[model samples]
Target: MAVTFYINLAYLLGAIAFVWGLRLLSTPDTARRGNILASIGMGLAIIAAMLAPLENTSNNYGWILGGMAVGAGIGWVSARRIQMTAMPQMVSMFNGLGGACAVVLALVEVFQFYGGERTLDSGQLVIVLSTLLIGGVAFTGSLLAFGKLQGLVRDNTLTLPKHNIINQIMLLVLIVMGVMLVIQGQEAGLTMAMIFTVLALIYGFSFVIPIGGADMPVVISLLNSFTGLSAAAAGLIYENNFMLVGGILVGASGTILTVLMCEAMNRSLLNVLIGGFGGGGGSAKGADGDQVAKEVSINDAAIQLYYSNSVMFVPGYGLAVAQAQKVCKEVDDLLEANGVDVKYAIHPVAGRMPGHMNVLLAEADVPYPKLLDLDDANSALPNTDMVVIVGANDVVNPAAYDDPGSPIYGMPVLNVWEAKNVIVLKRSMSTGYAGIQNPLFFHAKNRMLFGDAKDSLNKLVQELKNL
Candidate 1:
């Protein structure tokens, strides 16, 4: 019992470390250190868990050890081998696994209670129901998000008529079933638990499927919150302080991120929850063979911008994929040295999340003054000599202006189309994650440079040096 007290105290200390790590993670400069601190805390928590006594006659220790070993090995390999491009999918899977673990814990505890007591008391029933509902929702929703991020499923919106009404009705039924389970407390409890799990799984899928790729980051963050909440519910059931604290950290951070993302898009969290922006509508896709825009060599683009007075650079997810921020900054520096003013146009929802583009650029030590938000950049576009669209698509699409039936027609965009000259870097004329072709590529003023982002940027950098 004394040992148990010591182990619990140590676990509490470890949990505090997790909170410290989260605080450090708020800034890019400290993010690496924060992750290291968090890992150390987790290691300490594992030791405490392993040392906790479960009685000599109990075989639970062996199962715990085996499960820990297997999970650790898999986590190690996955973290070491995953590519940066596939990080989103990896995050979803990891979060999903955490949720699944909570679900298993809840179910195991329920089975144990039923095996002996044969019927759950009201308090136990509530705990079991909460864990099942939260865990089940996180599990299935995370899987669907993972599928979308991995391109295993269509990234377009999945919606049907009267979807909101149906979702509401289902929620009401699930709540009623949960209450009945608590009151009935025997055969009905187990059956209701199963039904609640099923409803949760369906609701999870329904909640995420309508969200488009553009909102995948927010969806992932929200699911992460759900995972944490599920873990917290399980912790309450099992009386685990470490689980409660860790889950609270995850839930808090995830919620903050969700709010930040919502603000970046100038949308309320409720609006996003109601499924308006991310969903696909009946917007018409552009006609095929619409590649009227001409592809230019690195030399041509360099020449066009070399003598320009001012240039605005627009970056998107491709910049992060290429990890070309440093290269981009170098080009900007060279342009500035030659009396060519260079500025960055950052879209609000650019890259995979809010401020993702800004973070990547800042990592390369780009000047803070040079970074311009959508509105600021839009105001400067008409006066700019050259607007460089670096691995961007949807943000500058001209169809948004003339095509009233377009999915993104009403959404605000950068005024790059109004710039004097537009140069775009891309691999092909393929549409963006929104699953729609950008009419900006077909604009007569826009010139495309086809190749890998880094390679193209590097070539253009070299070409500019020669000029």
Candidate 2:
């Protein structure tokens, strides 16, 4: 008991460390050290959790230790091997694994209860229900998110014929099943458990499939929250304080991130939940804008940037894909040296995840003071002389301004068209994740400089240096 008290104290200190580390990570320069500190805190928490006694008589410490070793080995290999582009999918898979673990743990407890070896109580039953429901959703939802992000499956929003009605019915049935399981009174409860598990699996996939690809970052954060909540539920069932605290931290952080991301997109969480954007390959049919080829030369682009007094740099997934953040910074430097005031305009959903663009720019050693969020940047775009859009598409589209018929019409944009000159670096005129052409391409003020982002930026850097 004294040992358990000491472990609890250690766990509290570990939680403090985790929170402090995350605060440090919020700043770019300290992010790496923050990550390392958080990792150390997690290690300490794990040790304390392992030392706590299991409530059940069926103790298999050796099996638990073996499983932990195997999991750790796989995690090490995967993290070391995966590419940066695949990071989002890796995150999804990791979330799914956490959910799977919670589900299995809850199931084991339920099994022990039903086998007449352990008594079930109301508190434990609530924990089991919560874990099963949330973890079940997280597991299947995250798997689908992984497939979409990895391009293993089509990024199609697969909505039910009568989605609202169907969803309501499905949810109602699941709730009913959970209530029944809780009240089954110990008479052959295995069937009830199986039924609940199956319902949860179906609900999980169904929940994620209808969401479009453009809103993946929010969905990922939402699923992350679900996984954390599941872990907390499982912790309560097992009476583990560290698990509860850790899970609560994850849930709170993920929820905050999801809200921030939604705001960045000028969207509400309800809109994200009901609208379901970011499926990947396709979405529900919407207005397809006319495409026109309007191209320009690197020299023309350079002249515009060099002469402009104020320039807004808008970034997107393409910027990250090319790993051109450093070269981008170089361009910004050159533009600034020429007396052009430069500020980075970042969209909330820019890149693969929340804070993704910020992460990339931080990697390039861009100052946080120079980065502007959507609202702040949108206001400045009108007075700007040039808007240098690097591989961004739908986010800056003018169609969002006047075309009520367009899918993203009501969605707020960067107001780049308001600038005196818009210089866009692109490989091709392909539509963005929305699968619709951007009308901004045909705007008279916008000039498309066709090429790879890295090559184009490198050339621009060389041209600037020569000048």
Residue lDDT tens for model 2, 231-335: 888879888776787788888999999988777666788777667554333322222445465787877778777888998899888887877889999999998
RMSD of each: 4.0, 3.0
Q: What is the TM-score of each candidate against the true structure?
A: 0.82, 0.91
Q: Which candidate is the best by TM-score?
A: 2
Question: Which digits, one per residue and each the tens of the lDDT, describe model 1 over residues 1-467?
Answer: 89898898889889988989988886666777889999899888878876775565665877878988998999999989986556678888898888888888888876666566545579977987788878887898889888887778774346666666777787788889888877876757455566677787798777776677777777788889989988888878867788888887788878888887676555566666664443433333453563476888888899988899999999988887887778888888888889999999988777665457777787788877788878899999999999988777767766666787666665567879789999988888777655567777767778888988889889988999998
Compared with the true structure, the alpha-carbon lDDT of candidate 1 equals 0.78
TM-score of 1: 0.82
> lDDT per prediction?
0.78, 0.82
Model 2 collision count:
10
Worst 10 residues of 2 by lDDT: 278-287
Q: Runs in model 1 with CA error above 4 Å? A: 1-5, 54-59, 117-120, 155-161, 187-189, 273-296, 304-312, 320-348, 353-387, 396-421, 428-430, 436-446
* Candidate 2 residue spans exceeding 4 A from truth: 54-65, 276-293, 336-339
